[model samples]
Target: MSTVLPDQLGHFGRFGGRFMPEALIAPLDELTRAWQEAMADPEFTGEFDRMLREYAGVPSLLYDATRLSEAAGARILLKREDLNHTGAHKVRNALGQALLTKRMGKTRVIAETGAGQHGVATATACAYLDLECVVYMGEVDTERQALNVARMKLLGAEVISVKTGSRTLKDAINDALRDWVASVDKTHYILGTAAGAHPFPAMVRDFVRGIGDEARAQSLELLGRLPDAAVASVGGGSNAIGLFAAFIPDAEVKLYGIEPGGDGFETGRHAATISAGQVGVLHGARSFLLQDEDGQTIESHSISAGLDYPGVGPEHAWLADTGRASYRPITDAEAMEAFRLLSRTEGIIPAIESAHAVAGALDIAKELGPEATILVNLSGRGDKDMDTASKWFGLIDAPEAGRE
Candidate 1:
C-alpha cells in the first residue's frame, strides 16, 4: 500500500544500501533515476500496464482449492502466478526492466538466474523488445534446469554458465555483476529478484506488486473479504513482497514469508536466511544472509534451486525486524509433502519453491481451523520440475506391468 522505501541513501532501515564496488555506483544511480522517471510518467506506466494486460497476461487467477480447503479444514485460496505467460511471476519485473533498458537506449540486457525462470522471463522480454540478451547461470543450475536453459536459448538469449564459487545463484550474481561493470555503458543488468542494490529491491517489487493488489481486490470481490493470512515462498522475496505490498496497510491481514528449510534447520543445510541468518552484505545489498562466524558467506542448500541462495531482499529484513511480518522455515520433506498434496487434491502441480508456501499454509490452516482463510502464492508451475519431482518421489521408474 505504501511505496516509501530505500530513502535517499538507499537504506531500508539499515537493511539495504549501495554496498557495491565504485564502478557499480554510478550505473545504479542512473538506473535509479530512470526508474523514478518511469514511475512518475503516465506514458511509461500506461504502456507498461497495457503490455502486462495484452502481452504478459496480468491479473493471474485466484483459485479456491476446495479439496485442499476441506482437507486442511480451512478455506485455501491460491494466487495463481504459475499461470503467467512465462510460467511464473518473474515476467513482471523482467518486462519492467526490459522497458527501462529500451528507454535507456541500451543495446543489450544481462541477467542472473538460479532456477532459470527469471532468465527465461528476461529472455522473453528481450525477444519482445529486440534487445540482445545474455543470461549468466551457475554451471550446476544449467545442468539441473536444462529445460529453462533451452527455453532461454530458444528465445535468442545467450546463456553463459558460470563455473565459479559454489556454481549456483551466488556465483551467477557475481558473474553478472562483473559483466555489468565492464559493459555498463551499453548494457543494462536486470537483476532477477528484489534483493539487489538500491532501486532493484524497490523497483522489482513495484513491478510485481500487482500480485498483492489483485489478490486483495479479488479476495474482497469473491470471498467477500480479505484473507486471514497471506503466504508466499521467499527466494529473494520478490513474489512475497509483491503479494505483501498491497496488504501492508491492512493491519488485519497477516503476512507470512516462508524460507526453504532444506533437510531441516538443525542440520545446517537450509536456506532459511531470515530465520537462521545474521545481518550481512551479499550481492550488493546488506540484508539477512547465511554466514559463518568469521564473516564469510555460507552456501545455502535447498532442493528448490530457486530458494538456494543465502541472502534475501532487504525490505524483508526490515519487515522481520519491525515484526510487521513473520518469517517461517519449511523443511524439504514438508515442502515435498505439500507438493504432492496439492497435486493430488487440487490437481495443481506447484513449483517446488511455491510448495514451501503451501506447506506453511497447511500448518497455519491446521491451527486456525474451518473459519480461517489462507491465501497461498503458487509462484510457478511444476512442469520444469517434473524430472526432479518424479525422481524425488521414486516415480521415475515405470510401474510393473502386472501390478494392479
Candidate 2:
C-alpha cells in the first residue's frame, strides 16, 4: 500500500537502477526531470484520460468466464485487456510515453520489441500523434513476427532489424539505445517493459496501474467484495503490476504472478524468471535473472514472446523479497492447453503471455474448488500467435522451422 520507492538507491530492493555509461547519464537525468514535470501536470492528466477512453479504450471490463468457472469448480473472471486497440495491453505504456514525448517537445520515438507488439503499439501512437517513429527489432524476430513488422511499416514507422548478439529483444534494446544516444535532441526512448532504468520502471508501471484501478472497482461492484485472488502473467511484469497495484493493500486477496515454464521447470528450457532464477542484474535491473554460474545471463525460451525474458521487473523482485505476493511458473504445454480450453469453452482466445495466467488460474481454481473467486489479467489476444500456435499444436504441422 506504500507509494514510497523500495530497494536500495532507486532499486526495488536491488532490482532497479541506472547503470549506463556516463555519456548517457545526463540525458537520462534530463528525461527524469521532464518526466517528473509531465506527471505533475493536470493538463497532461486530462489529455491522457481522454486518450485512454477515446483511443486505447480504457476501463477494459472484468468479464465472467462462466464455462471455465464451472469446470474448475470456482467462479472465474477475466480482466479483458486483450480487447485493447492493439490486441494487447502494451498500448497503455506506449501511449503514456508518446504523450510524454509530445509534452516534452520531442519529435521522434524509438523503441525495441520482441514479437513487435510494443513496436506496433508505439507505431500506432506515432501515427495518431504524427511523430516520427522508429522501431528496432531482432532480425530473427522480424522473420518470426513478420506480420507485426509489416504492420509497423504500414503505420509509417521505420523498422530496423538488429543483427547483433542474440538478435532478439535485448539486442534490439541495445540498438535503440544507440539510436537514442545519436538522436538525443529529437528522440525519446519508449521503453516497453516495467524493466529498465530508473523512472522507466516506475513510470511504465504507474501507467499500467490503471488496469488494476479499473478491475478493482469493477470486481467490487459485481462481487460486492474483493475476489479471493488476483492473477496475471509476468514477463517484464507490467500486466501483473498493473493488475496488482490496486489490490496490494487488500490483505484478503491472494496475488499470483505466473511465469512461463517452457517444457516444465525441470526441463531447463523455460523462461520462469521468478520461479527458477537467482538474483542478478540484466537490462538495468538486478531482479530475478536467468543467469549462468559465471554471472552471465542465460538464454530463455518461451512459446509466448511477451513472457520470454531472462529478467523480471524490479517491482516483482521487491514483491518476492517482501513476500507480498507469490510467483509460479506455467509450462508452454500447460499454457497452450489452457489457451485451447479458453477458446473452446469461453469463446476467448487469450494471448500466449496471458495464457500463463490462465494456466495458473486453472490449477488454482480447481484447488479452491467451488468456494473462492479468481480474476486473471487477459493481457492480450492470441491472434498474433495463431501461426506459431498452429505449428506448435500440430494444427498444420509445418516443417522443422516455420520458414521451411
Candidate 3:
C-alpha cells in the first residue's frame, strides 16, 4: 500500500518488472518517461479529465441496488462502470493511454483483448483521436464475443484473429507483444489491463482509479461511511485494482477479488490464477500463473471470454501474498446464476465477468449478514454477451420454417 511501490525499477516487490526483448527496452523507457511527465503536468491532466467527463463519461453512478441487496440479504452498493461509454471500464485506460500515445507523438496504437471490450475501447479512442488502430484478439474470444469484434471494426480498428495457443486472452497478448516489438517506434501498445511490464500495471491503475475515487466519495455521502467490503471480478485485475487502490488506505474496508472458476477449480479448467497458481512469468511480467511442473503455461478456461487468462496482474499477486486483500474463485455455474439473478432482480444484465463479483457478494453477504453493506464493481454491461448468455440459459430457440 506504500505510494512509493513499484520502486524506481518498476517492481512491486519482485512481482512486477520488465521481462521483454531487448527491442522493447527503449520504447518502454520512453513510455515510462512520457507517462511520468504527463502525470506531473496540469495541461495533460486537464485534457484527460475533460475527455473523461465529456466523452467517456466519468463519475459513473454509485447506485443503491435495493432489489439486489434484498435478494442477497445485504445492502449492495453498485459502482456502475457498465454505464460508461463502450459499456465497460476499459474505456478509461484506453482513453488515457491513447492520450499518452498522442503526447508521445505516436500515430498508431495497437492493443490486445479478450471479450473484445478493450479492443472496442481502444478502437473508440483511436477513432476519436485520429490514430490508426489495430487490435489483436484470440480466435476463440472473437467467436464468443463477436458483437464486440464488430463494434471494434465499426470504430475503425483493424482486427486480427490470433490462432495461436489456447486461442484466448494469453495468446492475444502474445501476438500483441510481437507486434509491439516490431512497431514500437511509431506504435503504442495500449495494454488493457493492470498487468504486463513496469509502467503498464501502474499506469493502467492510475487511469482507472477514478472508479474507486468516485465510489469512495459516494459511499461517504450515501452510507456516511465506507462499506464493509469492496468486491470485483479479476482477470488481469484492472477493475479490481482500480477499485482496491483507493480503499487500501482505509483499513476498515476489506477487499475481495473474484476469479473465474470455470467449470470448477477441481476440474483443472479454470482461470482462478490467484486462487490456484504459482509464481511465474508471462507477457513481460512476473505474476501468479497457471503453469505446469515444467513451467509451461497451462491453457485456462472460463465461461466469460474476458476472464479466460493463464496469468494475473502483478499487483494482484503482491496483494495476495501480503494478505492485504483476498482472492476467491467463482465457478461458471455460480457466476451465471448471479448473472441471471441480477438481470431479474435489478433489471441490470451485467457482463459475465462482473457476474463473478456478484456471485461472490452473495456469499459475502451471507457471511456478514443483512446488516453489513457491500460495494460491488459492476464493471461492464452485458450487451456484448447476448449470444453466450442466450445459449447458456436456453433463451434462444430453434427457428420455425419461414420465420425469417
Best by TM-score: 3
Writing each residue's lDDT as its tens digit, candidate 1 over 324-360 gives: 8999999988998999999999999999999999999
Better of 1 and 2 by TM-score: 1
Q: Write the per-residue lDDT of candidate 3 for residues 1-404, one digit (tens) a residue.
A: 58567876678887999888988988899999999999999999999999999998888999999999999999999999999999999999999999999999999999999999999999999999999999999998888788888888899999999998888888999999999999898999999999999899999999999999999999999999999999999999999999999998888999999999998988999999999999999988999999999999999999888899989999999989998899999999999999999999999999999999999999999999999999999999999877778777878785532211
Best by lDDT: 3
Model 3 TM-score on a 0 to 1 scale: 0.98
* C-alpha lDDT score of every prediction, in listed order: 0.93, 0.87, 0.93
Give per-residue CA lDDT, model 2, range 232-277, as digits (tens). 9998888999998888889799999999998788889988888899
lDDT of residue 301 for candidate 2 = 84
Candidate 3 stretches greater than 4 Å from native: 399-404
Instruction: Give per-model TM-scores.
Output: 0.97, 0.96, 0.98
Model 1 vs. true fold: TM:
0.97
